[model samples]
Target: MTLSFQRIAYEALNVCNGVTMAALEAAVERTGLAPGAAAIDIGTGNAAVAVRLAERFGLRVTAIEFDPVMADLARQRIDAAGAGAEVTLAVAGAADVLARSAPVDLIVALGTTNVTGEGRPTPEAGFTALRRKLRPGGWLLWGDIVWLAEPPAPLRQITEATNLYTDDAGWRAAATGAGFEVITGRISDPAEFEAYPRDAVTAVRAWLEAHPDAPEAASIRFHADRVQAITDFGRDYIGFGVYLLRNPD
Candidate 1:
């Protein structure tokens, strides 16, 4: 599962998820986890959030990304930040890390809803598995696609194939069902939501232009076109949101 284009696109994007830096930092502040607490950022694209956590919030962060390409970039980013000791980059699947690790103070899974589960990822599967990775009262900063309006069958079929999506209420229910207490959740600003795919498409286009003869150009373009089309079509029915949840104290 190498998304080479994603690495290039992330160079131009803020975070892999549609989450803004300000919003994620705010969500971290909401966690109220003190300095020196432990945190793991699953599917941490470029490990930007992880680096921020270790540097600003004084967290001992384990930034996880399975893609070697992205993980390499994250490793370089972490090393250059002089946060080598504070931020540990793990090039492994989230579920693998979660299974073996001790409970931490916070777990941040943004955009990568499949942080847990085998087949199609769902909120319930993710929440349940993640519960074991945190201590009581620990936080889960989760962000993913939410159905703003009922999607057409065609779009729904396409969306669910990658990762299961649901409305805001559906997400809250899944969290509570998995024993997490929902603290707060926010639907993204329309403009911010709009930037996600647009930024990716723009970056990919630029990369393709620069590397026109590259062997992977075709694959990258195909992915970019598919994503751009789907995103454009689904904009009316789907939106992104971040939810802050906590394990029972």
Candidate 2:
């Protein structure tokens, strides 16, 4: 895989323990989902968040992912983690999956919101989709990339227009539209921003050195530039944060 793709996937995966994980944990705790409360994880890549919710918080989880590969991976991981009974895997987009879901106690989208093809649908839009699937006072945990800087044209194009940029006010506005009250939100620490790229670069470099003749080596090297660009960008732009929203009565 290209370094950029790998980095993006890895970074998303890492969020399982970072801000996304913290946000989900907090949401679970704050919402006080009874031991049997149902929860859905949107864009549940690798379903790590879903498994975590069930295993840690004792909630029944339904994990929805758009990519078949990712959904399968999540299923495998959940099975291996012995959380299959607590988690269900579905291959579908968030907006679509939520459309079919009945009221639950919580909805979470971690790093998957940007791929929804609706322009990251402000928190308000996100909440609206989630609100339908969650009961009153239900919790919505959203994790997405926000602008750390005004991305240069080159970087923006290179990223294939997959980046999103939003501020606190912008997010709050969206949550209001979705019929939610913003409970708590915080940006990822600069340390996390710096560390992610640093680790991605490290992983890429090690792989390149070990497999210099691999067929995908060129592609990997080409995308290493993205890693460099992201590292440089994070110098100023704080890129991601987690927001917890609660449906109002």
Candidate 3:
């Protein structure tokens, strides 16, 4: 099905996925982390969460991304924030990056697993990979889109075909099996969003306008279109999810 487009405004602030930045700040405050705590954000796109953790809680971050383009953008953002040293943007997948890194106090894989592109990797395996990198009692914050109802055939086909996703319960079960205790889970409140797919669309549009002759414009346009389609259907049938899981202390 065809989808219309929306322009993203750079002036618009990014909204946190499910948990607001304020809530994340509160979590840090409650934890009473020392001046230099460590955190990792798996599949971190543009390092938004990593930047938030550092700026809000004074934590150092290791932001991992497999996509070079996205990782480069994140690196630019981190550097521009004057936080280059504070946040390390690793251009590697979760298993590769986490394996070499030290155990972190927190790991966030927000909206990442869906695109892992390998049958969702069984949440059990995903958690097992993450568990190795988490310090005992460290927290893992996972976020993704889940079906609000049995999705229409088109949406299901799009998701399954792309390895995108729709299994909130399965994630909970996997976390449980992986020895993680769920501390909390919540659907994202629209109010908390700062940066969004709209911004992404805008980014793509601007790139198209500037580089009209560029060879990659078609691919970029296609991505923007897909994002717009998902956004259009998301409100009614798809909900973004976030789960805060912890290793037993």
Q: Which candidate number has the best lDDT?
A: 1
- Candidate 1 lDDT, 1-249, residue by residue in tens: 354778888877768777688898998898878899999999888888899999889999999998899998898889989999999988888888888899999998887845664866668988898988989889999999999999999999987876888999999999999999999999998889888889989999988999898888999999898889888899899889899999998
Which runs in model 3 stand beyond 4 Å of their true positions? 1-20, 26-31, 114-119, 161-164, 190-195
Poorly placed runs, candidate 2 (over 4 Å): 1-4, 7-23, 114-123, 148-160
TM-score-superior candidate, 1 or 2: 1
- Model 1 gets an lDDT of 0.88
Q: Clashing residue pairs, candidate 1?
A: none
Better of 1 and 3 by TM-score: 1
Tell me which residue pairs clash in candidate 2.
Answer: 123-174, 123-175, 124-174, 124-175, 148-237
TM-score of 1: 0.96
Models 1 onward score TM values of 0.96, 0.82, 0.81
147-237, model 3: which lDDT tens digit per residue? Answer: 6778888878876563455567877888899899987766656644323665657766876788777666676677778868877875577
Q: Write the per-residue lDDT of candidate 2 for residues 118-174, one digit (tens) a residue.
A: 764544555576677778878888776665566666655644355444666677777
